[model samples]
Target chain A: MPNGLDKPETTLEKIERMDRRIVFLAIAITIILPLIWPLGLPIGVSPQVDDFHEAIESIPDGSVVLFPNDYDPASKAELYPMTVAILHHFFKEDRNLKVIGLGLFPAGPPLLQKAFEEVAVDQYGAEYGKDFVNLGYKEGREIVMASMGESIPQTFPTDFFGTSIDSLPIMQGIKNYSDIAILVNVSAGYPGTKEWVQQVVSVFDVLMVSGTTGVSAPEYYPYYNSGQLAGMLEGLKGAAEYETLIEEQGIATSGMDAQSLGHLVIILFIIAGNVLFILNKRNKNRDRGGRF
Target chain B: MWELLGIWIQVFLTLAIFSFLYRDNPFYKFAEHLFVGVATGYWVVLQIRNVLIPNLFQPLFGEFSDPWLVIPLFLGLVLFMRLSDKYSYMSRWGMAAVVGIFSGLAIFGFGGGDLIIQIRSNVMPFIDTEAVQAFTQKAGVITFLNILSNPIFIIGVICVLFYFFFSTEHTGALGVVSKIGIYLLMISFGASYGNTVMARISLFIDRAQFGIVNWIPTVIIGILMIIAFVVLAITGKVDPKKQF
Candidate 1:
């Protein structure tokens, strides 16, 4: 039998065996071009985000809004903008809401603090101790959450900076789930929205809204359907939709063009891959007796 | 100036990491190692500052030390014993306490929230009378598709569950149902994959914008990377093991 390498490489073979760098370069160009010149493509808002907005808006004035910024640096690209946008809504709204950023995971606290600095302080001139307090990362996942159900200050003795929660003006009168009006959860992975949903929301009957990473978004659908979650945001597209709803175009909004075009490129590659795979399969079958 | 400097450093790191797509090279290796070291150092400091010092040390040894805190302090020490192979067995006490507490907490949470609430919700109202009325009256522009959602949802849930029921062989009519279940699962998986792609692309867009807006530094470094890569390839210095 002739060696496969000795045979001339076909067009199908060339395309199939093409350098991975070409694929990467193609995706890179598609993404980069759109960043330079945005297409301004229209995007529709999903019902989940609508519910999320309404849930936030429905919070009574002076109610304590406890939001867990539960994302690591790896998820910052997707979840950080959502955190900033939500912070903007909380600070800008005339609700007199005491929005506290709680960090259940270690990576969550800094992102929350960064969002606060970027949106609440830099843009809206909101004070830290008065307007918001970042109850930085604690070890216990479910127990810590259950503890918060009892007492917020006890669960988180100190804020992110290690100042006592007792000292912070933001923690004044915010004792537990009963004191808190809403839970807006931003999650990347485990010990995240699900834990909060079970430990906090279900335990206390506390109304909640969640923004989760794309891969984990479907896990929350049942929660949303069950009315356990008042609203949900599924990833970057969800973030972009939220930006549109707020009418404040930021990074998420501008990135939509690239997001769309990049997806298109990926789809094209998928189609090409399927076609090449079919061709290869047919050739093998022809080489055989065309029997299964 | 510091802000700009920080952005430049981030850009350099991003480029260095992305260089791995070309081939495993010095820059990629350096960036990877640096990331591991820096992240470890940062996490260690954070744990000491935010957790250990505040939660354990201060509570036990601060001016108004709590005598009751010794129990936890001892347990924490037991956990540290895991570092030594001889004393690793002692770490189980701490591990047991952790697992027990979390399990106890999680059981309650899952029981009241997920098990009950989710099971009850699965009994979806196939057709809501109020929804039908609304659609008929055109009160909210509700479509028939809206009404069909619950039925489709219930069917999907049942089919997916059936697919997991390995006790029954997937044959004949059951095979058809199983096939449907698999199709639904694939569709769901496809959607999840699509969302993941969107997330990755979004990150790429953000970084691309950063590089474009800071073209001055990016261009200089990018060109240097290309030159170095070419020179190495010409000299046959490119590591064959690293190449795909």
Candidate 2:
């Protein structure tokens, strides 16, 4: 009897023995290489992202917009760019944004602040407290949302900075959803885009838009189709599309080349992975006297 | 110069992180650890500022102060009590409070928002427009199918509810309907899984684009990663099946 390790390797053995880390590595390289030296692949704006832009653009200047940063660092890769692009549009158009954090994920507030500061808000003379106020993370997700729908000031007495909401110029007249022009929900998971739409938007009938991970996008499509959500930005592709739109208006087009290349590399890896699996499977089955 | 330097640092960090795609190695490990450390540090600071201070502390001292803050603060303190072996049982109170609050919130939210509204929305007529409604009414086939589907929808709801019944044995027509209900549930889950896979694949694609851009330094980093993979493979330091 031969030891298990010393036994002659079969095709099935090789197939089964294939390393998943290698696949991860392949995927990593495929993504990174493109980011570094982008192929500058052409990307078209999806209607979802386009509609989201149109909705925001239609909102009058100085209009109070409820902007929820309903995500964390885990989803930063996808949502961050979208956040920047949207903030550019809002700030450029001179719209007042009331940023809210629904997620208890502590990283949500500063991430939004950093993105806003980096993405043209500084140049556009966007001031905090006057132009925007971070409401921070409110405890009791759905309860707080319901409370917010009833009364914004009662739910969040102060902004994230511990400053009184009553003192903020932007938040002065904003009592509820009725007061806001539109809702821009950038969400990752639970207590996110869906929660806002269901708990607040549905009853208030507020015009709402969203930017969510690709995973969450399809679930929101029914709402979009139903006209409950005016528009949506779906994942990084949606972010890139929105970025492209912004850049065309001369905001952040340079980044799109990088974004497009990154997407292309990933598509290539998926193709490579599927090809390898098919090849490996065929070889194994042939050896096993099974038809491919 | 500093701004350009910051951009380069970002580019390097991005490259370092992406190096993991080729293989698990020291470079990837270093980057991963650095990210985890920085992220955790950032989170801890934010939690202190946002959740711990405002929700937990200010409520204790601020004008609208409440004694109830003590209850949550005590419960939260009990969570740290878990670090001590002798006081591990104390942590259960905190856990219970959290679980209870979350469960109550889920039921309340889901009942009012998801369950009621989804059903209401689906059952409601699609077209309120007179032209569309008149056309649909004139189309006898549409009216017949719509009428036939009403009972089917009711039957589906009953069957699905019955499928969850534990105390009683499903029998006769109920048993058949329950089985069909299980199949439908499974199909729904499978479709959800398919959608999730598609989303994850899109995410992976986004990451890959970072590495493949025309920048010279980035192209060099990509080459280095490949070389490192080959070196590790040649040295037999990594067993692909086990490591991956």
Candidate 3:
């Protein structure tokens, strides 16, 4: 029994060396099940997301909300839902609010256009170049934002369609950051919330919120704590929370049950990994006659 | 019909990329190469459409008294000089201008906003009553959690700062403080990892919804992939012993 090979392999040993494909398969099934079969999961709203919702609510009527739909297709799973929900909330018939949609990332516009079509066009029947203006993709990120503080028209001379900004009714009197009420940066990081903080919020003192990927959420807490960021919506959870606030059971809301189960799987793995590691370590130490 | 074709293409690509989870194969490589190529092609076309024509060409040819714009235009063009050995020196002119401008911009932007403001804000009351009030504004257990968390925040900040202090050796009280800092860092890292896991799961869920909701194309692709894998295994192209 003192020699490891003399004894049968323990359950720990067998499970520890199990092929990782099993875990992938497990995760795939758990996620796919919820997608196929609808589970009406009750979602709780987080304080940060509540703050983000309130920030939007606080935007005065007739004021413009600059929504920077700044992310690529890769982030579509998380950020795309947030974009749809936010647009749905913004273009609500009662609000009478205008939004200037733009992005630093090139891929963002097309996706934003999709959101516009789905939420703004179909649901709200919002007119193009009147209710919302897409500035397309700007190449310069921080520099472009900083320049935007000077003049929005100068920063972007034309709309997404190459139509002159002067002609678009939405662009009328929207000179700079000062004219804008609040900016919601739906970002998947760099040249996003951070850039907006530096170039616009810090410099021009623009009120802003950010809906970012889960990974970037921790870093923005300090900004949220400092009151620099008005609100924070982090990842799919944030999207679901925002959807809840808007009273819309969208894609993110449906994905919640799956997200929770996947998290449970990870937690189980982490606990198992630590427990097995410690036990195996002790066994190995005993075999070595107490040598570390 | 076009929409159906698009969906089929998308499903094929998704399955091709997803097959990598099983093992490395030509399908994954093809999808990867196609993605990179398409992305590069998109960026080039976008840059020309957005930048060259609208910002530079349209302005230069359309204007007479635009001396200010000409300087930037010349500097941008000179950046290509690096390709030629004889004119390589001219590239530095463009590079220097860029570096200098960015450096100046960043100094003010980052220094004043992120660094100065963040550091200043961190130096707050250890037990922030206002933050407690904000938490309490919303009902439930979060209020109690916020009350406990308010003090730990400042402590976490201090301990983490202490851990990074290499000028003085960590001994006595310093060691104890830095040791706490290590724990705080581990907690932060664990949170980050948890978030990353959630992100990855969400991505998988998105794809699952895409495929499962549109079951026809997905079923077709899934069968094809299984067949291809079976064929590869039978042909001895992918040695199972070597792979997994």
Candidate 4:
């Protein structure tokens, strides 16, 4: 009974029941090493991100681009790079950027302020009142979105920093959704892209694009296909792709080698698990006289 | 100097949270509580400063610019009454107003966006020779791939919708299409799961970047944590097996 198959069977069984912590350690190492020393794997651009860049690029220069800063610190790792990359694109192209944070009220406004300061103002030398404006966070969720469709200044009379809307040079000639050329949303979760689509994109004729959390991306494919969203960026991969499109090597791109390696590790683990399962099943069948 | 301090704090917290990978301990508990407390506090302060003051307090105090603002302010205050036993009933009026307004808006939004527009978009030409011609012109090929895509899309949509039709039992031809629907659903779910795994790993990679690249201090902190863990385990204060 202690034959060639039986000897290997014990090893397979051991692997099948291998300690989970070992697996966790492998994953941790797989992610960490690549991150410490990046391989710079080329990320293939998705048609969706291609469309997202094109949507922003297609808008005439100096036209208003209204997108929300709709995520917080929890999702900063994935969404922040997208935010920075997109903002960089907007500023570089000389677009009149109007930023807002209506959803995730408490979390998004401060992050949006930080993003604008870091990307739009500090990096691009974009004049605040003239080139871009931060509408800041407002509560009311979908209701605020609906209201913005009606009137921007009425919904937010003052910017996040307390500057009156009338005083901002960028506010000139931008009265409603009609004046806005495109709505680009880099969102994390609910009351984010879907709410915007329902309240703003569908109600008015504003062209919409979104960069959402990876988990929420599949459900939104319908919206993307339907033209409710002109283009979409799904999670960190999408963000990395956008950064590539803009010719900037940011955090998202830096993390991609780690991401690729991590994904490979997971897939290998899965394959190993399946092999173990199959071997165990075959051994059980052999024990049962070729499964009756 | 301030930046270094910030980096050190981040390292400490990151290591503290990662310690849970080993076992539940005081460090993990401390980090979790601190994260929740700080995030909640930050959110509340931001809402008050950015939203409440500028939107509500300014309008109420500075001028009676829009009297309708008072109505919402009253309703919002009434929401707090639920914390008390006797006045909890008064809170229902505010709750009802909120529910009623939201429901009404949702119905309108859903019907217009989710129902009509979504349906309209799906109602494509089953066979558009024009589209085929345009693709042929653009790509310089008379391939049937463009024409074939439409029929496949239409069939897939119908079959998937049919699978969700619970009113009738799937039998015979219906059963076959329903099986196809299940396959389609599985394919979509598998693709989605792949995306989710990538997203989650990216988060971990970001944390790794923070610990290893942005702050080498965290590696030292991580080592110190491991020593503490081992010490605790040796003293019988922790059970490493329990984590497994």
lDDT of 2 by residue, B209-235 (tens): 433433565666667766776787789
- Put down candidate 1 lDDT per residue, A196-223, tens digits, no spaces: 9988788788999999988789888889
Q: How well does each candidate superpose onto the true structure, as a TM-score?
A: 0.95, 0.70, 0.95, 0.92
Which 10 consecutive positions of candidate 4 chain A have the poorest summed lDDT? Answer: A1-10
Predictions' DockQ, in order: 0.75, 0.23, 0.72, 0.71
Evaluating just chain A, the predictions reach TM-scores of: 0.95, 0.84, 0.94, 0.91
Where does candidate 1 stray beyond 4 Å?
A: A1-6, A287-292, B83-87, B138-142, B239-242
**Candidates sorted by lDDT, best first:** 3, 1, 4, 2
Using TM-score as the measure, what is the rank order of every candidate, best first?
Answer: 3, 1, 4, 2
Interface RMSD of each: 1.3, 4.2, 1.0, 1.4
Q: What DockQ does candidate 2 have relative to the true complex? A: 0.23
Error of 1 at A56 (Å): 0.6
10 residues in a row with least lDDT, candidate 2 chain B? B205-214
Candidates 3 and 4, the one with greater lDDT:
3
Q: What is the C-alpha lDDT of each candidate?
A: 0.85, 0.69, 0.87, 0.83
- Model 4 lDDT per residue over A88-124, tens place: 8887765555544333445776677777889888988
